[model samples]
Target chain A: MAAFIIANGAAAMGDDVTMFFTFWGLNALRKPENIKVKKSFLQGMFGKMMPRGADKLGISKMNFGGMGAAMMKTVMKQQNVTTLPELIQTAKEQDIKMIACTMSMDVMGIREEELIDGLEFAGVATYLGEADEANVNLFI
Target chain B: MAAFIIANGAAAMGDDVTMFFTFWGLNALRKPENIKVKKSFLQGMFGKMMPRGADKLGISKMNFGGMGAAMMKTVMKQQNVTTLPELIQTAKEQDIKMIACTMSMDVMGIREEELIDGLEFAGVATYLGEADEANVNLFI
Candidate 1:
């Protein structure tokens, strides 16, 4: 959530923002609806265990069986802070580059069609190249 | 562990490295010996619950009640990979700059006297200033 907020904030300020999702972070990019993609046994189990999308994500701290996430969302709504989905939408609207690490996707058996639209799938080398040119490259 | 390894690697290559420790990352910078400091009840509890130093830290993944961390350390030893403590020592030896986030320390109730020596304390503004001048700034 911090990553998205920062990315959106940077984009809002006319800064070119790029978000690279890898490993568990890729779960945030999964479509809310289940996508029928063939996978190995372990990957299938992994997929079933992991949350599908941003809304399904749990807060890192004090997530008492997801109650904390619900409370956080409620508080955020009350505070008029942009919700995670809204932040994601804003990111798309602002043309923030969202890249999913291809190596992680392959390792986790996540197919391209399983993720949302407007994402570029690439490897770490691409991220490194981008980082080289970027003034601030953050790994959240 | 990744942070320390990367810092050590970068410093070894003669690139000036600065590691800004925040939140749980501060635990790695703590002195192993118990330090008696006056604190609120909550602060004392927080300090007691958290790991004191790098050696007491657990692996993020597959750490089944610290067994996984022990297994990983053994494997790292077998593979000749630098241990976390060794990586931290190498970072110090190579003159890598390490800063502990003061805001995080206050929030987590960690004291300067409880932390290892050779660390600078600063806030986010200092991080931003350093990052602005950095060619590649990574959050991790």
Candidate 2:
């Protein structure tokens, strides 16, 4: 199976990270200025989940005042861990691969024209080829 | 890179659910009866300062505190998720492959004999095969 951590936490941990920009995942890869926001509890209770772009669902590191994202950054910083922005730059510099799903882009009305530069267009087969070979895979 | 969610969380969320176990992940794979008591406060504090496994340094889910473990189980039930024990059994039934790092086990004083049955012993090469092949990999 393909392990997907749709979230961007890995970048902050300073690991080589790649995100298959499918569905919500595209939010982060989209124009950086375009911040994705998640739906509210009322949505889930009414089956009206927001399912917004993924960057919206990031885990708050410290979760202070629901500032988990900021808290995470602080804890990691106190420990000398890297930040998400830094991770993105590092992965690109190190040649860590990033794949954006063509099908997803179409389904969500996204266009390659909308994505940030330096992304590759791929499909299920590409994801599977990478996932099947991994000894450890995760869907976060 | 590996994704490590404490198998002990089985009590908080049932184990039958699919959880990608890596790093201290193999800790839960140890036998339930042999599980050690929860790591100490000092250990937790140190872990807070160290990398993920600092708390799990000497413990696995199986031999960890029975009372504490049971409490985790109760919380998961209240939360409506699966239990850890059930997760392990489910992993077997689902054929979710789990690999225990030989190096960490060695450093932590664990032996193949101490782990829960059915674990695959592997090293960097094994992980490399998976990492190179997988589209998404993580270290949590």
Candidate 3:
């Protein structure tokens, strides 16, 4: 949620924004109904235990069995702020670059078709190359 | 560790940086030997179970009984990268603004003395004020 907010804000300000999603971060890009994955026993457990997508994700701290997430959503709504999904859509509309890490996808058994469309795929080198020239690079 | 790495890297590159420590994030600023807190039972449990300071912090993912943190430290050493504590100290030396959220400290019953020196205290308003003027604002 924070990533999408920042990305949208930066993109709105005309900054060239790139969100490199890797590991669990890729969960945000997963289609809500198509989040199934095949992996080792423990890895599969991890996948099953995790929230399906951005809408279901709990906040990192003070998340009282998902209550905190719900409260946050309510607060955002009350404040007339865009929802996480809306922020993501806004980011897409603003043409912010979204890169999915190929290595992580392979290890996690996530296929391209399972993710939302209009995203590029690359490895660490690609991210480093972009970070090298960028003035502001963040990992949220 | 990720936060410190990014902070130190940005500061080294002559970027003005501000890290707002809130809730669990304040744990990283706690002085390892003096981390005692007087909160509600559950909050105290949360405080006690968490790592004491930057050195004791575990990674967000793949933290297998602290092994992942140890391995990460080892890798940093092998790569001639600064440890988390060292990176934090570097951030301090580079004059990166470190703000401990007053609201979080109050809720957690964390005394200001328990945190490292040479830091400031503020609320969200101050952070927003800084972020409003800055070209690069990130939450980690």
Candidate 4:
């Protein structure tokens, strides 16, 4: 969410933004529905254990099971702050480059079909290349 | 540890590196000895609860109390990998700029005397300025 907030803010200011998702961050780009795919037992377990999408992700701190996330959503609605899902939509509309790390995807058993549309699949080398070109690069 | 590894690697390659520590990351730069300092009730509680130094931090995953970190250290030793403290020392020798966030220091009630020697204190704007001047900027 912090990464998206930064990306959205930068994009709003007319700066080109790219978000590289790796490891657990791949959860943010996952489709909500479970997509059937063949995988090793360990990978399958990992897939099942991880959250399905942005809406399902738990906060980094003070997340008492799912209740904390629910309370946060309620407060966000009250304060008129954009929800995570809405922020993701705005990011898409802004044409922010969202890249999913292929190595992480393979390790986590996440397939292309299991993720949302409009994401480039690549590895760390591609990320390094982008980082070298960009004025600012952040790993969140 | 990942951040330190990257910093050490970059510094080893003769790249200018600056490490900006904020929030819990400040713990790594702390002195192992308890430093007497005045603080508000909440701040005192926060200071006491957090780990003291690099040696005190638990691993991000499967840290069954402190056992996981101990196990990791054992493995690193067996593999002839440099320890976290050694990595930090190398970073200092390489002259990697280490900056602790002053705002976070205030929030966590961490006095300047509580931290190790050789550190610059600054806030987010300083970090942004440094980031803007660099070819690669990462928030880890």
Report, for every candidate in turn, its global Cα lDDT versus the true structure: 0.83, 0.51, 0.77, 0.85
The runs of at least 3 residues in candidate 3 whose Cα sits more than 4 Å from the true structure, single-residue gaps closed, are A35-47, B1-140
lDDT of 4: 0.85
Total clashes in model 4, counting residue pairs 3 or more apart in sequence or in different chains = 0
Taking all chains together, the TM-score of candidate 2 against the true structure is 0.43
lDDT by residue (A14-121, candidate 4, tens digit) is: 999888887678998899998999876656766777789999988888888778989999999999999888999999999999999875676566899999999999
Write model 1 residue lDDT over A14-51, tens digit each, in one string. Answer: 67888899999999999999999999999898899999
Query: Model 3 Cα RMSD, Å?
Result: 7.3
Q: What is the TM-score of chain B in candidate 1?
A: 0.97
Q: Candidate 1 has which clashing residue pairs, if any?
A: none
TM-score of chain A of 1: 0.98
Q: After superposition, how far is residue B77 of candidate 4 from its true place, in Å?
A: 19
DockQ of each: 0.19, 0.13, 0.12, 0.20
lDDT by residue for model 3 over A1-140, one digit each (tens)? Answer: 65776567667766788999999898888788845555678666666676667797777865768766675566456446677688778989999999999999888767787788899999999999998877667677
lDDT of each residue in B55-80, candidate 4, tens digit only: 88887743557655675566456445
Q: TM-scores, in order shown? A: 0.60, 0.43, 0.56, 0.60
Tell me the lDDT of candidate 2: 0.51
Candidate 1 docking: what grade?
incorrect
DockQ of 4: 0.20
Q: TM-scores for chain A, candidates in order?
A: 0.98, 0.60, 0.90, 0.97
lDDT of 1 by residue, B59-116 (tens): 8779898899999999999999998888888888999999998856775678899998
Candidate 2 — which residues are off by over 4 angstroms?
A1-19, A34-57, A60-65, A130-140, B1-140
